[model samples]
Target: MSKKQEQVLCIDRKTLPASWVTQRTVLSMDFPTFAATCTKAKCSFVRRGIAEEDRQKKQIIPYILLQTADGGMTAAYNRQGNEKRLHDLWSIGIGGHINPEDSAIGTDSFESILKKGMQRELDEELARRVAGDPIEFIGIISEDITPVGSVHMGAVFLIRTQDPEGYLPGDELRSFTWHATQKLSQLNLELWSELSLELINSLNPTL
Candidate 1:
């Protein structure tokens, strides 16, 4: 096995709640299948409406969310020209679309796909921030369907690190910080999606 696959194997799924384990099976069936159906229908509809050239350029994006041991979340902002808009950040998880390469892995199982997707996005986004350091995988904590109108399936992973100090926001992020779990309600930031919040609450219920 590759080093990355070996590290992923070290994650202990037994550490998660029994209820979460059962729920994961149900979610794996519901969301990914629903997402696949939606993608097919959307592509069919778009192909009928647009020109051939435009259709070829379209892309579908996958979704991902990241949780830190501390409760702080990552978000991006649009700045006005040259003003250096600080604090315009929003709260969100790290994830993107599943590329064609991801589809060739021969995994039809949603759980397998979700796990692979998490590793891909984390490595792509956090690599530079860590300066090539390693990230340890924990286990999946929760999963959810995005709003009906949205075109992405969301999965929340419960990740922990002995050293939670190396993370730095990339250019897309205005700023990122680890906030106390209790203080999440006080901030004006967007509320984390239900699954994301559930994972956080599972880890630190008092918050």
Candidate 2:
């Protein structure tokens, strides 16, 4: 199928209360309830093209942040990436639209299916064999001010890589650059990355 024709998942805006996705990048305490909303999301099926254009719907995406055991991250410049809005920008996360085929693992739960899709994205986007288990769900991100962010809600996840040198970029990403907190602000970050930087900076030894 074509990229635009791909069937993806989304939640109804009316069903997803405005309060659920705030200016805040992270969701805690009510995270379980927030995630449960995705599992209970109605009208989950929609074409990528239509979904991208529909602000009334929030495309549920798993934005996986690849980190080393020591908290270093694998980031890349995205000049040849799929999303044009993020062209020539830097990103710390690797993820894509969740499709119906994600359920091939025979899982009924949305979170399980979401994880499967996330792994598929990693396998497709990166050259190395990153560990699939023990991934952490950090938080959700939304940038209502931007057109691209207004339509989708990112379910942020963190997966660890053994070594930064072990991971390689796919077609969209040129090379994987290892970065620590001190070096992040030097690059032009995409919307999610900008938010991710803030989230990471705000952390104090947790998440």
Top candidate by TM-score? 2
Q: Candidate 2 versus the native: TM-score?
A: 0.86
Instruction: Give per-residue CA lDDT, model 1, range 48-98, as digits (tens).
Output: 112212312222323344444444543322222221322343444565434
Scored by Cα lDDT, where does model 2 land? Answer: 0.73
Worst 10-residue lDDT window, candidate 2: 22-31
lDDT of 2 by residue, 85-196 (tens): 8777788878889898898755457766777888889889877754544577777777677888888888777766666666777776665677775677788878887776
**Candidate-wise lDDT, in order:** 0.39, 0.73
Question: What TM-score, over all chains together, does every model reach?
Answer: 0.48, 0.86
- Misplaced by over 4 Å in model 2 are 23-25, 28-33, 72-74, 105-107, 205-207
**Total clashes for model 2:** 0
Question: Model 2 RMSD to the real structure?
Answer: 2.7
Q: How far is candidate 1 from the true structure (C-alpha RMSD, Å)?
A: 11.7
What pairs collide in candidate 1? Answer: 62-97
